[model samples]
Target chain A: MLDTLDLKLLEEVADLHGLPQGAYNIRKNGQAADRKTTANIDIITKKDKPGIDIVVKPGTKEESVHIPVILSQSIGDLVYNTFEIGAYADVLIVAGCGIHNPSSEKAQHDGIHEFFVRKGARMKYIEKHYGEGEGTGQRILNPKTIIEVEEDGIVEIEMIQIKGVDHTVRDTEVRLQKNARLIVSERLLTNLEQTAISNITVELLGDESTAQIISRSVAQDNSHQDFHLNMYGYSKCRGHIQCDSIIMDQAHVTSSPMISALNTDAQLIHEAAIGKIASEQLIKLMSMGLTEDEAEAAILKGFLK
Target chain B: MLDTLDLKLLEEVADLHGLPQGAYNIRKNGQAADRKTTANIDIITKKDKPGIDIVVKPGTKEESVHIPVILSQSIGDLVYNTFEIGAYADVLIVAGCGIHNPSSEKAQHDGIHEFFVRKGARMKYIEKHYGEGEGTGQRILNPKTIIEVEEDGIVEIEMIQIKGVDHTVRDTEVRLQKNARLIVSERLLTNLEQTAISNITVELLGDESTAQIISRSVAQDNSHQDFHLNMYGYSKCRGHIQCDSIIMDQAHVTSSPMISALNTDAQLIHEAAIGKIASEQLIKLMSMGLTEDEAEAAILKGFLK
Candidate 1:
């Protein structure tokens, strides 16, 4: 069964006009309704893929579940295929390795869109890429997600790359109807190699629609990273993209966020900074007898803080 | 005669107790010897020629007065070379530059170094390099400065560049005595194809001495810039080097801040970053009825702020 928090999130999505009428329908399979708008899958461990495989109506609110375990550091590209977001269901929970697909470039686009379409739901998914073992490869695992939305829906998506991951790339695309909205937030931790390019594109088809993308990245050592964002605002929709990166050591970071306003009043702002730990600060700390590692850690903490 | 402010700053330099001594002296021409420890000299500024040309005794205090009506931008560096700070006197002053340098590079570095070598003086200098005309190829006017400090003296220097400017380069070198201290700071703002490279080297010959270098540069358009800071921390002296640069559009920036911490406990830190404007933020601002130029200006102001 669905929990209260998940229910609340679904309600919010529905209330936000993120779904269209008749987008979702109830269906049954065997002794159980194969897709229950109310029932939530308990868990989908690798030992037992016991979680419910959902089929969403065009525009129904779906259950939200937390998948804590699906992270493989070595995977280069993971494509989400075969999952469709229906017009009725407005939410999708990618609990485990949401998009940390190493090989399948179309995993999220193909796998995830299939479920959304079957469920008839406008999708809002949170993909967490977890890592195990000593992560190698300049290419961290990436989960590529694609969404095809009907008219008048919304999608709020977030991707957070925790520490200990090698590198990560997030490529997401959204096709929105009139008055549709998409919000994407991405957070990147330290320890990734260069070439961590995160690309996001939101295309507004409907009039007065909107999209916003926010990205934050922290780089240390010889890491090289880039954040590329493109928002195409058509039909008089408004769009925004913002990226911030903190560089430490010889780490190299580049951010190029672009917006194309095909129609009048289609609006966009970008800002970036590069700085080093102040030396007076280091001397002040070293004067206190803290080791070099301690001093570096303190500065990093202070910078993030 | 040396004023109270000048004397106080000199005292601060002398108090460091860890720099090459006798390298800095003050002499006053045509003045009777007196009990005052300050050296004050009188010199006539010949038209189109440097006013103070003189020498100093080893380990002695000398002073000379030269009031040149030069551009404000050219004062510091010119002052540096005129007195040969590294070879002789530590302090030089050109009463004031009543004229502004306008867009001339030769004018800016004219008298930058005179007050820099004063015993134990650590100071910050901020320069605004904006002009109405197009920026030139030669942005920084070189001013020679020579300094041999006594044991246990200290110096800290900083230069911040803001507004639009052309190419610039300044060469600086320092040799420290036992237990001396020295710090240097450089900041650059370049738009278009401007290129500026500052070459600085500090040799720490005495034990227990210290030197630090800090620099920041911002490049825009097709501009290219570089920084090279080399420090040799001989004996038990400490050396620290840090440099950072931010590039936008097709801009390119590089930094090579190297430090040879010959003794244990010597340390160095360096960092750099390059990124373009965020698209989402621009869209957001544009949605607020701001033009693209206004949005960019706002972001730049906020970033520097």
Candidate 2:
């Protein structure tokens, strides 16, 4: 059952203003609380574990699927979800997890998700990690996303973790086949001694394949973050990886991005930036009547947006 | 004779409102236009070349010196300049060059400047490069800056090149001794098929030495830019280098930064980012009643600022 706090969290993470339409699965307190299956999509619970297998037919189109998890008590939860998208199918998959810990104990969530996008299919995946509590309990989330794109498949991913996660380690690996394309955009924020680590590796293994990975993050009040991204371009492909972080109030950030190209026609580039807020930005906002703090917050909001 | 165009170029490069008061030298069209020396600062013209040796007294303070070069006609100019700051002296030096070529011939300026900041002294150096004309001839500038800081010395450098120049090559090298500190900030802009290349190297050779190099650049309209920076911490020291660039309208930017730390206590970091303007920034400005073009210009201006 979803309470007021649970509803607010669902809204915060997945924009589930009400119950999601089409096919959906809601997991709460380490168990599935609700589920639905549409005509074109099938959700099968894993017999051996605490997860599900989502399957879409070859001609499925314009369908929205939501699989969100929420925890309101101090506990440790793990799940393995697999997605099989058939050829020529187009769908949006929304999977976000939120945890609340009000006790002295810790609340953690670990999820491993694997997606297989079939030939000529287009998939858009959005995942958000969120934490909320009243007491001093630490909230943690670790997510691993593994994806394989078949020939001519297209995928766009958005991963966001912007508040109240005391610690997290996000791992992602992706492989692209011939003529496939991928775009992954990620954002994160940490403050008050929180720590976040991200490791991502993408390989363009077929000709004419391309991938772009972009990340933006901010650390404040002694928080620390590390970003490691590796991109490989082979067989007349192209890839790019970029990382940008803003460090404030003694916070530290480390960014290391590597790019390798095997074929002579393959092109790859990597870029990273770590710095504090620009004083001119503050001045410009102040001239428009906002205080320094307000200006900095506005700038950071725009940065993450 | 300093014509109106020459005076405008002077103001654009060095902020020269009138004849400089304390110590000044103005070079116009491959010849010296004016020269002046104050009580504590001596400008010695080199007998064998078209350059000068600047010597500052041991205790000179709160004074400014200006050296400006203006090329109104198509010509090639080369000069070698040196600075000798006595022990415990603190001063500011401004050196800027502007070229105007309204003919069918190439115009170029090559300058090599070397500085020695003695023990316990401090120096502030600023240089700007600009070009303007209405001709097909090329406007090119090549500058080299070399500096050495003795024990307990401090040096701050500001180098800016914005607009007009068709081609440029900038080279800089610095060495720091025990307890010395160095900070160098550079900014550049290229447009309309222009090209710019910058190479810089720094060595922290003694205990407690620290150095920081920051560069911001923009390339637009088929322009090209390449930035290469290297920092070496050979002892118990710290060093940081950052390069940020905005690429627009088919432009290309390449940033390569390397940081090496040899000692166990040495701390070094390097960051670089090359991207287009953020859409959020544009929307933010557009929300404030500006058009898209106006918003983009504002963002670029703030970025360079």
Candidate 3:
């Protein structure tokens, strides 16, 4: 829900900008980063197509310079719908990846990043995962991202992933320079699927900078949710994180939120929590005449309370 | 921090079994349930009073039936240690008057509540406004709790409150069945004055039920922390909770955890995390290169390319 819709609001912001490649230009001029180029090799990116079907490889020679990057991916149906995040690209909205219908997802999962990369743009990316079919089995989508931010640049990424029958493997990378800032928020709701692994990396190669990460999740039934957030802080840098999870029934949730401050004055704090519901507490409420939904609502509300 | 070795373990499991009220028992031939008496508006029976300076009141009254009760007061510089789940009579922890500290905190911020409530006992109570201390003032601690469960049954309650400059408030209630369960977890890290309105109500209306709650806290930079938790459940039930908090740069934190369930099949989960570090993200690790903490370790070992 939005409070108000101001169409020209982006133009008012000094750093406001947007991806220039319209859908048509994106389809025609945007091609995958040149493939064939290899870097420190890791299996996750080994297929070399850079995980893209079209065999374009990363250009030879590392960009060496730190450039702000934001990763974006969406999983579910609803592919053709348009998404808008102010012109500055601070908010990333992702939709469209068939995760619920196993048969449809087998075809392929497509990601759109070439448009921004080709423009040499630096901005935040918002990723959203939603479902269209009734029940958890009809929709599923999985996507990964990579982002690099330059000095004094800022990248804010917000991802909301709701699991369907299909799972998602999200891997995002960001390299920041001196004084660069990055803020990432990942929210996940998992019901179906064996697991959801979110792998994120941020290199603080920069000095006196800041990075913030926050995650909230709900794991129910037999679902498994794992999150790995690691931030390496330089001297005089400030990094902070908060990770919270709610587990139900046989559901299991694991969170590893860590901060490594190599330099003095690198104030950093990391925290994680996992646990199940209280039954006797619920019965006491019921005995008080509250209905089942009321009880669940009350108990569940306390997670936020 | 625990007062004794046994208190250490008790802090870890108080949520599963009711905190023990050692030697605080009613004379076997003293009074019957209907014959119990009270002195304060708040009710406490002969069974709940120990050899203490102050008592809240006496007698236990059910909405429909009456039960036995007890009361006791904690003196100055007294770090009332932890209590075993199976070593004492069913009890309630309450803070009725006010508490004060000299060095770390000032007055104008005092709260009250019973530290431990017995299992298989119906309990109810409330606390007033709570806050921070002033120059040369004192710090206050007021927390109240109740427990009800069968032999070996358990209940635990944890709270944090910071309201005004002169005082604070905390209230709790719990009830258990022959073998019911309950647990409480509270964490608060803040500096500003805070008032807490807390409650915990449970009914052991069943056999073999349980409840538990845990509180974790870290405060720095002159901030105040406040928290409150409410728990209630029934027979053969089980409950667990964990709350973690960290404060920095004169920041403040206030929290309240509530648990309520109905049927014997009820199972609940609650977790609260308050911190300044996003430990599960790779940004911190990439920033420092060291990967020893849980979040960093997961990224270095489990989060591949």
Q: Candidate 1 regions off by >4 Å?
A: A1-54, A58-62, A65-79, A95-122, A135-139, A192-194, A274-305, B1-305
For model 2, how does the per-residue alpha-carbon lDDT over B104-189 read when each residue is reduced to its tens digit?
Answer: 79899999999999998899999999999998889999999999999999999999999999999999999999999999999999
TM-score of chain A of each: 0.64, 0.98, 0.59
Off by over 4 Å in 3: A1-122, A131-142, A274-305, B1-305
Least accurate 10 contiguous residues by lDDT in model 1 chain A: A25-34
Q: Write the per-residue lDDT of candidate 3 for residues B96-164, one digit (tens) a residue.
A: 222222344332222122333344343322222232223345444444333334444444443433222
Q: Candidate 1, residue A120: CA error in Å?
A: 9.9
Pick by DockQ: which candidate is best? 2
Candidate 3, after superposition: displacement of residue B171 in Å?
38
Give lDDT tens digits, candidate 1, residues B1-305.
45443333223322312221322233222121112123433222324643443333223333432332223233333442233232233343322222233334443434434332434432222223332223332334343334455566665554444543454566667888877777776666677676666777788778777777766666677776666566654465556555545456666544444443333333333232333456798889999999999997787665553
Flag the better candidate by DockQ, 1 or 3: 3
The global Cα lDDT (0 to 1) of model 1 is: 0.48
- Tell me, by lDDT, which candidate is best: 2
Better of 2 and 3 by TM-score: 2
Worst 10 residues of 2 chain B by lDDT: B257-266
